[model samples]
Target chain A: MTGPRLTPLAASLPDTVPFVGPETQERAMGRPFRARLGANESRFGPSPRAIAAMAAAAGEAWMYGDPEVHDLRAAIAAHHGVTAAHVVVGEGIDGLLGVLVRLVAGSGDRVVTSLGAYPTFNFHVAGFGAELHRVPYRDDREDTDALVQKAREVGAKLVYFANPDNPMGTWHEAGVVEEMVAALPEGALLVLDEAYADLAPAGAVPRIAADDPRVIRMRTFSKGYGLAGLRVGYAIGAPALIRAFDKVRNHFGMGRVAQAGALAALADQGWLRDVQGKVAAARDRIAGIAAANGLRALPSATNFVTVDCGRDGDFARAVLRECIARGLFIRMPGVAPLDRCIRISAGTPADLDVLEEVLPQALRAAAG
Target chain B: MTGPRLTPLAASLPDTVPFVGPETQERAMGRPFRARLGANESRFGPSPRAIAAMAAAAGEAWMYGDPEVHDLRAAIAAHHGVTAAHVVVGEGIDGLLGVLVRLVAGSGDRVVTSLGAYPTFNFHVAGFGAELHRVPYRDDREDTDALVQKAREVGAKLVYFANPDNPMGTWHEAGVVEEMVAALPEGALLVLDEAYADLAPAGAVPRIAADDPRVIRMRTFSKGYGLAGLRVGYAIGAPALIRAFDKVRNHFGMGRVAQAGALAALADQGWLRDVQGKVAAARDRIAGIAAANGLRALPSATNFVTVDCGRDGDFARAVLRECIARGLFIRMPGVAPLDRCIRISAGTPADLDVLEEVLPQALRAAAG
Candidate 1:
């Protein structure tokens, strides 16, 4: 009469989501939020051409999507000025992280990442029974040198660092990141998550050779391209490393509309440029609102601005709760120091108007 | 410099796709497929309501899909007379199979399935480093009793059985399947893939209780709902087993448009019934065509018919090649006994007209 047996690794794992989506919160709250700016998604929607492509492809959904993702890969390769051999498209950076961890790290193998960076990466590493080594951020930025040193010390199989980083909205110059890449141990692969690369200032993303076997850079259409719901991302690496993904990935996991939409999005660089300008304006507006509320906003190069509440973790948590209570969906880091800051994604003017009105009230409520 | 090191298990695995999609073949041939009947996709297309829903949601593709899949799960639960707790939606059955295998069977764990039943399932088992013990089909149908015996003998953690099976399109009565479920070995969970259940005849699918812990039934929108490219599938089981998926699944894997499309498709069951009728008629037409070509068409409960080529595996392969060369897409099983048959999907009138014109020529070419 015994029920099914979960593997010991799975049984030991916690039942948790890396991030609680805003939709789940809305359901729990029994109402939708007035401002949705928590997940770092682009407030400006995708290009009209991309939307048209997706709508046009809707009826053709009767056929399975191309398993190889041929066209999208080709376009991504061309965009990066590389050949198709260096690209591997997947369900998103989240999906690709899972596959990447599974490919490199086995049970008990050591991996390194910045603490409070991205929970999804930790989740994947833990799900695979790999040992995780965390390095703390230095001055609100990912400590790349520390990460590289830790990997060497632990004989780590993989090391993860995100440029134009999440949570803190800080980044290192391409030259600094290039030096860190050079410092990577021979056996350790550097997973350079460039999810916000498109939004970063020039020279923030390193111009590495596409065939650099020591690093795999991941880019997504979710943020700057405004197609978060489509779940399309691609990894750029050596041909051999990229091809290894073929061994374990669910080949047909990419939706047909997703492929078409991403291809259309990639084709419209003008839309991307316009959105970047909009995001910059939105970020300045968010910072101005924070300043008006007597909060210090951290300098940001990405789509989001991290505001320092100038308080402890509990105080920052209270501020976040007050914002959520007022229907402003904002989030904060999960750990100390970084937890003292509240993260806010750049939203449209209307969305920011709601935020601007609520932040003062939320701040007063948190102070009380 | 050395590249990333793959895990021993990943290194040991072969870099091969379980099914070579027709799209890949078309790319190789440097042309679009004239008749896409190789995969058993619903050529009649999704419910117009579903297509409209997807198109409408296309503009809102900036928001991430609900990770909980709350509304769709509730709708699926209502349809199956189960609670939301009994359902877990995923990125197609292929993706779910990978997660299920990872959860239940670890490296060196035993899993049982019919040989050549589903290569995708085998792919997942291998990807997880699990040892698979396959029981061959008997009389061109999956031998459930033999599978049960093998599971018991090997102490298998999971056993996979597909009702209204793929490739052969043969099925057993509900009572027989129920008996097999009851006979499942302790600690073994039966994975009943009902991908084609909506098209199955009465008594072909068992009326199992949703709380049955010994079995997890998987259903897909790809077949009957005609949304193959959307990649939505759901697994039904006891609340405990269903919730286990949350431990390891990609939370944001399901696309927003896919959820909307599936919800709309489920609401329009009338469209489902109409598609079923069309599939039935197309199946009959395919059988008639086979008979006229001096081939024996097997009894089928699913969307495709398997025609015995009156020869061996090589002859069947030659016929399949001829069909492809004549600009018609058809497929055949890859293993022995079943490899002697060529499989054709039910298509629209226009698609069938192309098939009717090309199939006879294919046979003649094969004979020569």
Candidate 2:
């Protein structure tokens, strides 16, 4: 018998994962990595209060999580100084990006982003049959001018920009971001992804009116709150745009335990400050290890440090391969120029010790 | 400045939630639900092993769950006597259905289901711009022949049939299901949702070959496993179809604690057996309560029972309202014939005492 006929769009899409998780690599290698630093996950654990809340909520696993996500939304709104109607929570920023793409970008609709921005967002845009137009990064940071200009030229529906950018850990000042928001063409929404906002320097985060219809910004608990495994992220936008998410979202998708954990995590700002301190220290340690190995570490405001291999993409690839072979997990950008760098997330002091020991060996092996 | 313009389809769709969560009602009423029976959650709770596993995993929440989901997928495969290639895990069956609809049913593609089938599935179809066609239930069961006929007539890409169906608690035997599968149109896939399979009779689940490309069957931890709050569900199908989910799914969507909890829950089938016994006992208790009140309980193969109010949809709705007003949270079907009944989920001995106390008063109020 013939199988079901897939839609042309589905059939045309490549079966590719945006990120090959470290677990897949571990399985292929037949051993676990000594240091889990890939994927930019927090090496520091979530707040103890969050852990306790989740553990307590475990017994109530028989009931569905609140579909409206009432308590968490209220708490998030208070944290951001916005009304509840301005916030929408989803599985994660990745999931919310997919829904946001579906909401605005129809088949053949033009969407714009930088060449080396989050591949997951590009995956969503392609999956929805939208035409993606990407501009090259100007100087390892996303080119704001080129992105907005491209959006205007294409009459784009959505434009994606991440502050404290991934892979490079570089950021723009709040004023630059405000200019980008102001320059966004009519009918083109700016998807200002502030996933690393919690760790960003104070002046790096732009302050836009909550009701500004020009932008929808996403933030995640995965980074600063150290709850990556909880899969909670949210968007703050104009009320109308936020309400539109309910039309398509999986209403009861959030887990009850996750809700409790996030609530407790949000309440523990002291723990967040502690993580910020640890992350900053870890970033410096990673940079020091990079310098010892004769590689250049990029300036970073986020939790991770991106080290330039001081050579081409091929050399960086070899260095990355050597590190993986040496039981250290790390990643490099897929695009050129940027691919000259290897991205390393902040790890514990012990994990960093492994990195310091392994880097010289890996560099020597790569050179050979 | 104007907001981003929504795609024509998204603009046409009205913002709606598939189900109003009990928590929302509680907030409006200024109290908690005395008996939360509306959502068909397992009051029996998850296995203690699962709770323990999740509680332990909570401390590891900083690390993202393995996106490959290797261990859990392998375990689920072993349990079903299928290779891991034949399985794909997701946030829930609701989330999986959304992806499946996107994979096979493009905008304007025809899909068939019972008029009063799972509203969430319908929401996904609508969200993706697929055209949905509904058939009426026959003898309180899904009309399999009608669904198949309509699929052939309209060249439908998908047909959804839930055995031990929601809202009505009716199911078809294995033979009937096999016949229906055989009758699926050349390009139409059958979405056999077995959400309540663990609680169904011996012959209710069909033993389809793993490589059979004509159908995909979904199972969940939400119902019989008593982990509704965990949000873990899986689909078994042809390897090619299962792999296609990766192209569009949120690859790292499944939470770490959720994966651990589900793995532990699957290992402890003894807990499942215990839950089955409890559900069966509660079903009997609910049926007795209905009989005592001079109402008819539909013979159920599910964790919930549907009791006919012996009048019209209006009467059933009135009864439901009274039940809600009395601090009992229960639901009625949204469509006619089915709407002539109110559905109640299995509860603890203590919870059923509330239902027992409240159902009679609700009926009396409706009568008045």
Candidate 3:
């Protein structure tokens, strides 16, 4: 290659997409999807106030956003009962996760995450050339005991967990999670991903003290707030951990409109509650439909419902393809055992109607 | 620390602000700048069509951006006469620089740049634990010969230069830069930042083949296209260099609204030309104003004009402070002898009127 040689790591890694976005898949399939349920997006849409705020800021797209993210951080701090120093907002939780991993992990350092958890987190670890230890979920929930054991055994510097997790909407109670936090080794830091916390029931979110430094929690406006396309997410942690981001972060990364849209989304609690209600209703509709099709829907504390296919991974995959063929965009776990199920995100009533209509035909075709 | 332990490289790094944003300073002073010219943002905002497109996208803020950035990359490639594989869209030049540095420069690797060149590039170098070699500019233009020599002397893996550079609106002719590229060490990559290329004079932007594997050129909508706050910048290079970004980039980092805005902006070449004309006239206005203030503005091929302060760094510092105190958000170079100049951006006639009205007062106060 006449181009500059990539550092050994970049040269070695393959060009891979973490998830095939529905848009790309639709393009490949030469059509649009009927029911948009994959990617865990809130089809209920963003807060009306956020949309209005974004429209208002559209013309002022010439000035850079506040690099400190001052206003948004202040609101988030007040909401969480923490100081603004405890928060760091970025492009999204994915962006913040990349920064956090860069802050701590280097080549050869060990980082732990549950296998088949959030691939984006693992992607960040691999991007930094860190070694990742994957502990398989126990009975669909991330095995917290296994995670702590591996962290201690490997002397990992960071361990990642998500409450009310993705692909499989399974979670442990707050007490059990607190026990896992207690078991983390002295040198190990926990990344508690609460991306779906808003959709999860009360008490599903562990109420850690605002000043706790052992764990850094990531939350996003993308999920329950329905602002995924706006690209806003934040991390809350010890002030020191938050400040370390300044050393390497893209200082002007956030778009001005996004910051404004997210602030509006955060402030409009009524709209958020309205979306949460819709999401809950959609989740029930999906579970009910899944049950009617002879599959068991996993109890969910998140926006998405995971339905056990009552068959194997191959059957589940065939079912997924059938759904896609019928214009439904749904997904399943990438790994074994967990792949025996399909994950469907909460959506509008019309989107669910499309899913309900397509499910029977897709299942019959898969069976055929 | 109870939080994550930073890696040795990250720990050694300092919490440094590469450039204090004009916004931060404005908040500190509890006032807004009357003439906002410091950040090189086009006071002439993006096209009305681009704004309309982003506004239309406001409702779709619930969906994540296409991870492949397929449409935006295709549009950029078409605009630049290259294949889709030749370009990668990112948050901005700053974000792209962070990725490129990570892809090529590892711990203790050598990278070269002009001493007072783009500070964000240097920040990335330090963030990655790379050894930075600074070559002082020859007469305010990045000394091409000295940069190549430094690269060879230190076996540097990366060398950076910005055409129509910032902090000092000085530029090297295309032929001179082409010669510099020809003289680069075999293994070193050239990062040609053309962020201001569209605003430059004739023959300033080189006609290098997009497939040239030895160099990667960066361009942004933030300048001539007047979309700075939108945070869209792209790198055009050989397929190899572009593909390397896929390995570590936040695949979904780019915002959906930004992608929409940039696509519309690129398609509306007429709007671009109109803005370019406005930029030229403003540059002239800024120059004439500087001349009336007893300071000679350097010939600029950029939106910003660097006025020679006719004294030492301290005098330029005083001039800058006086301008800021008088509500002009102008900036100056960080290192001598370029520090003997203060940089002012091209703005609308009304914006220039403010500068014209304030310059004499600022000068008088600085002298006292």
Candidate 4:
């Protein structure tokens, strides 16, 4: 009649998830948000061709997706001017991070990242019972020098750095990133999370060799490609390193419709350019709204704008709560300093209109 | 620079996958499969309602699926006569099994299952660095008593038993399963994989209390519900046991289309009943096909039939190769005794016509 005993590591872990999705908040409020500007999801939908592919693939839902994910991998490799051996696709960047962590870091292994970086990465590190040493964000951007120093000091197995970073949307140029790759401690692999790569300005992405063993870069269809719901993300690294994923990954985890949609989406680079323009325009609108509210919007190279609330974490928290109460779903960074800002995603015109109407009132309510 | 160092446990693992998907075989063969009966996917297809839902959801792919998966969980709970807390949905049964193994069994922990029961389960156990103790199948079925005895002997943390089992397609009634649950050693958990439950005979699925902590039962939409490509599977168990999944799982791994399609599929039980009838009829047709070829089909309560090749593993392997060479995608069990058989999934009448034509030819080729 007793339950099975969880492993010591599992028992020691908490039940807290990495992020509380907006759907969760909507359920709690018993109503949907007027603007879905959280989680950095694209308000601009995926390519019409991708939608058609997914719709067509839906009827073929009885067949398991190819375990090797052949066509998509080949397509992605060709797009990047690399071979299939250098890329491995998974459920998403989150899923790949979990697997990569498992493959490299055993219990008590050292891992490094920015303190207020992606909580999902931290979650994976802790889940695998690895010790995570986090350096602070230096001036609103991930401090590459500090991260490398920390990795060398700890002899860390992995270092996670998201370029054109989430929450802040600040980015280092290609040369800066290339230097970061060069600075990786011996035997310490850098996990370059370029989830927002498609939305980044030209030259923001580095020209690392596809066979670079010191780093594995992850890119997602979730951001600019606008298919977060499909859960397709991929990693590119040395063939040997990429091959190791097969040893631990759920071989047939990818969905058939997801593969089809992603392939079609990748093919429609024109649709991607359209999304990029729209996201850029939306970013400016968000900045304009922030300026009108007497708040400063950080210069962003990604799909979201981080509005400095010009106060403490508590004030930002209050503003976030107020926005949520006013039927706007928004989020703020969890740690201090970074927590002084509230993050917003690119939204449709109507959605942004709702934000425009709500922000002033929300700020007034929070000021009280 | 050198690549990242892998954990000793990960480095010790091999690159061998659980199953070679038909697509991989097709690629090697330089063609498509005429009859894809290897993976046990429902060629009968998903509910029309589910396809429609998935198609509609495809356009909404910009949004990440609800991380909490509230509605689908509620629907699955309602279908199973349990509360939402008692059910936890995941990417697939394979994905869930990996998480479950990580939750309960750590490095060097003992787990028990039939030798050839399910390779994917064994893969997860190995991937997690758990030591697996396998008992042999008895008379082409998983030996429940032997499994229980071994679990007790090893003080195993987990014991996996697939009812209406895969590959062999033999099953035990509910009372036998209840007895197995009662016989679980102290602190040992039973992973009851009822992936084929929807196609099983009445009373084959044991009714255990929702609060039973010693056993967690998994069911999938991939088989009878005919949505393998959608990748939705669920486990029912005590709330605490189910909650542990949140500690380590990829929180937002399930796709939006998958959730929507599964919800619609659950609502259309009539479609499921129709599938059940079709599967039963197909099973009979397969048995007839095997008789015509002078082979023996194992009695099955599953969507697939395992036909004993009437000779050694070499003969079955040869027959499998012949079928594959003829563009008939099928599989054989990996372990001996069971390896003396080739497994075939329920396919469309058109697909079965190809199987009927190919099986005899394959048999002749193997004989030569």
Candidate 5:
């Protein structure tokens, strides 16, 4: 017997699994990871103040948080040197991306992103039935000129680019980003994701004035701020675009402890710097380990290091499987050229020690 | 210049405010509430075990939560004596409602709810461009007969009912709800909201079969579990209906600490029993206060008590305003007949004392 009818688009789509959590894999494999370095999480953890704040606020989870998120928004405004009107906080950058996609791109509305850039963003576009124009990355960096040209060719309304990009962890400097922003077609808007901007070098993230209507920048507490699990993120843009969020956003969605934890995380800059330092060191250690295993490590400005296996995608995938088999949880790019490299997040040295020890064996197994 | 265009439906709808959170009123009043007896938050707080679990999880806030919510779902399944596939967790009941509406009702699709029922659910329906056919409440309870007739008339795909009703703090027995479920139209689905079910008396919430395709029950950790601010809610439904969420849900939306806390909270039945007892005691105190003020308090199976103001919506509104002005922060329903009462949440004895002291003066002021 027939049950319920899904929307035409939804009916056509398969009930595919989007992502499998580490726990699921561990359960399948009958073992836990020796090094949890996949998914680009900041294993360095959040600031002590943030942790303290969360622990203290833990008892107050009974009450619903303020829907407007005033204090957090105000703090974000102060940090970004913008008015509170310019910011809209959400569950995470992932959540904001979904809302932005729904707002700007409707059924078959053209949206542009680099091929295999951010799967989460692509997932949202697909959810709303947006037609995608996926440009290939040039030399592991998003090809700015190509993306702009495609956006204009298709009259795409929303363009997504992440500076200090994920999976590969490469970045573009402010000047190049500003140049691309200027090239945006009239009526089109750029969604510049700076989720990893804090870990990048100075001038790596564009210092756009928050009032700019042509673009919006997305940031998150997930990566450098070290509160990924708290699910807090904000976007900075013209008030017009920012206010549009209220029209569609889940008003009471933000977690109360998460809000308090994020505010404290933002206030403690010293802890962020300390985490950043640890991440940088971890990246170097990963690179060294890769080199010792006769692989090339991509230069990264973000928290994870992408190691090139000096081989094809199949070989790299085998390497990934071997590593996972050995209980070193890591991941790789899904597309060609980039797929020849496996991505590993920065972890504590002890965690990295497992990675270093396991990689050599995994490489040998892959070659065999 | 115009920003991104809202859909034609969104453009036509008025810019409405669904809720005025207590924080908003406190900001307006320039002081904190002495008795935070509004919004029906559990003043009993979460279980001590949940608090400890959350506090311990404070350090791991940097990692993205398990998108699958595997552990929590397993625990919920075990507790309910059902398979994990029967449960789907979300931001809150509001979020689950949004997903359900999206799955079934598109533009102009007929959906039914009680007039002045959960505004958040209505907000979601409007957001999705559904045609809402609202049946008025029957004697302070959602009218099951009227709702069934309207659904048949409209050929509605979805019908929403909240048992142990909000604002009025009223409920019907499980047998009546089961009858309502059986009487629903073929191919139509019912959203049975049991947000306050735990506090409800025996026979208040029906035991629908786990695989009942036509019925989906909504529950939350917000009321009895005392974690509204943490934003954890779930739905129990047939796997076919539940799996639809995977197509569009923000997979990693739930916070890790929140997941852990909710799991721990659900495990501590003793704490929940203690809270239930406290809530029952507080309800008695609230009724007594209403009686002293010459107002009849409606019988409540929920955390809040509704004091009948002995007139239409207007007089109760006046009482609500006075309470707000005096920093009491109590709320009343926004619509007719039901607004004939002011809603006050269960709070501590100290909090109740403040309510007891201030409410009479507010009632006197409103009488003028």
Candidate 6:
């Protein structure tokens, strides 16, 4: 018998993940990478308190987590000086983006983002049958002016902007982002992704009013708190917009251990400070390695550094291939211009030692 | 200024949670429940092996979970005597139901279920703007024949049927369910939710062909596996249907610790057997308590029992309220007929002691 038919929209969509994880790559390679710097995960690890909290909550997992996510939201709200009504906790920024897209953009709706920005946002837009408009980055950073202009021209429903952007490790000043938020077209939502905000310079992240209706600032524990595997992220927006998430989100989605871990992680800001320091040192070490290899490292406000190969995208891709072959897990952007730079995350000193040992060899191989 | 405009369908939807969790109730009462049995969770707890695995994974929470969920899917597939291609794991059945509904049923598409069946399924259908057709339960159990007939009548894309149904904890024989599966409409997919399958009697679960394209069987660690807080569930279906989930699912949604815990939980079948025995004994104790209070406990193939209060829906609701007032967390179904019964979950002996003491007082108060 024939199987059930997929909806026309689902049938038209491709079966693809936004990012192929490092574990999948390792499985294909038949061995683990010596240096796991890809995926931008924090290798310094979560706070000891967070780990302890998770371990403590492990046995109590027979019960469902609080569907309301009340305590965690309240803690996050207190941290941001906003009421809990202005925040919504979700699986991650990735999952939240999916729900936000569903709540605002429908079939044939227009969405705007940088050409080489986060692919997951585009994935959700396409999954919902929305038309995506791409604006080219200027000076290796997301061009907010062009994005705003494009959104207005296309009558877009959503505009995705990542401060301390991925793939290139570039960021905009807080004032510039505030201006962009204020300039968003009527009826358009600005998805200001701050996934890397905690690692960025203080002045680089804009302080928007919690009740700002035009923008939703997204943050995650994955980057700063070192809880990527826990899958906790939240968005700050107007109370009404935040409440709208309840209309479509999986109520019991958050794992109880995750909630406990994030709560502990939030309470342990000292651990976060330690991670930030380690990330800064790692970034400096990565840049030094690139400089010694006769490559230029772009200035970054994130936990990663992007090293320009001083060549075309193909040449940089060859360098990336050599690194992967040498068991140094690294990634590069998909779109051109950005692709000339290879991205590497801030890992522990041992991981960086592996990278230091492999970089020259990879460059020589690519040159040959 | 107005916030970003919600899609017409999202705006029309109400802000609702399918189930009000015990934590929410506890918050309202400003104290913890003496006997936590409202959510049907296993107070017996997860396998010790699972707890240890989660504790081990906690330190590595810095890494992103495998987006593919490879190892867990392999383990699940091997347990079921099927290839890994036949399995798709997700963030529990609630999350999977949302994706399944999105894949097959779009706006205006018809979906069928029992009138008081799983509300989460209906929530997803409504979230996607699909029209829902619900048939009333037959003899307190889900009427598979009526659901299938309605699916054919309305050309429904999906039909939801829960084995050892929730709320009532009643079930049909495997032989009868097999006939209903074979008779499903040509274009309809049957969502066979076996969330309580492990607690069911031997021979009650029909063995369907692994390649059966008309049905997708959903099982969860939430109930019998004692992992509701972990949010792990899986669906077994034809390879084509299984792969289709990638189109819209959050690939990295499953937490790494959860994956590790479920793997260990699967390997420790001894723990599962022990839990099953505990569940049976707890069920007996719950029934005894009901009988002592002059209430008739319905025969349950699941971990919870529905006790008829020998009165109307309002009377049962009063009984439920009294139980809650006395700090014994219990729940009753929302609709008529089923509302005449109060649903109590199997709990630990000490928890049951609290229930045994308070239930009579609750009954007396309701009578007054």
Structure candidate 5, residue pairs in collision: A91-A231
The digit string of per-residue lDDT tens for model 4 on B108-213 reads: 8999999888999999999999999999999998899999999999999899999998879999999999999998888889999999999999889998999988
Candidates by DockQ, descending order: 2, 6, 4, 1, 3, 5
Error of 2 at B210 (Å): 1.1
Q: What is the Cα-based lDDT of residue A325 in candidate 2?
A: 96
Cα lDDT tens digits for candidate 2, B38-102: 89899999999999999999999988888888899999999999999999999999999999999
Alpha-carbon DockQ of candidate 3: 0.77
Instruction: Give stretches of model 3 more than 4 Å off.
Output: A1-3, B2-4
* Per-residue accuracy of model 2 over A123-216 as CA lDDT, tens digit each: 9999998999999998899999999999999999899999989878999999999999889888889999999999989999999999999999
Off by over 4 Å in 2: A1-3
lDDT of 3 by residue, B46-145 (tens): 8999999999898998999998889999999988889999999999999999999999998878999998999999999999888999998887788889
Q: Docking quality tier of candidate 3?
A: medium
Q: Write the per-residue lDDT of candidate 1 for residues A1-368, one digit (tens) a residue.
A: 44447999988888777788898889889999999999998889999999999999999999899888889999999899999989999999999999999999979899999999999999999999999999999999999889999999999989999999998999999999999988898788999999999999998989899888889999999999999989999999999899889899999899898999999999999999999999999999999999988899998889999999998999899989999988999899999889999999999999999999988888788899
Q: Write the number of the candidate with greater DockQ, choosing between 3 and 5.
A: 3
Higher DockQ: candidate 1 or 5? 1
Question: In Å, what is the interface RMSD of model 3?
Answer: 1.4
Q: Against the hidden reference, what TM-scores do the models get?
A: 0.99, 0.99, 0.98, 0.99, 0.98, 0.99
TM-score of the first chain of model 6? 0.99
Error of model 1, residue A257, in angstroms: 0.7
lDDT of 4 by residue, A1-368 (tens): 45548999999999877889898898889999989998899989999999999999999999889889999999999999999999999999999999999999978899999989999999999999999999999889999999999999999989999999987999999999999888887889999999999999988999999988998999999999999999999999999999999899989899898899999999999999999999999999999999999999998999999999999999999999999999999898999889999999998899899999999999999999
Q: What is the lDDT of residue B78 in candidate 6?
A: 97
Model 6, position B140, has a per-residue lDDT of 91
Docking class of 6: high
**iRMSD values, candidates in order:** 1.2, 1.1, 1.4, 1.2, 1.7, 1.1
Cα lDDT computed for each candidate against the true fold: 0.92, 0.93, 0.89, 0.93, 0.88, 0.93
What candidate 5 gets wrong by more than 4 Å, as runs, is: B9-17
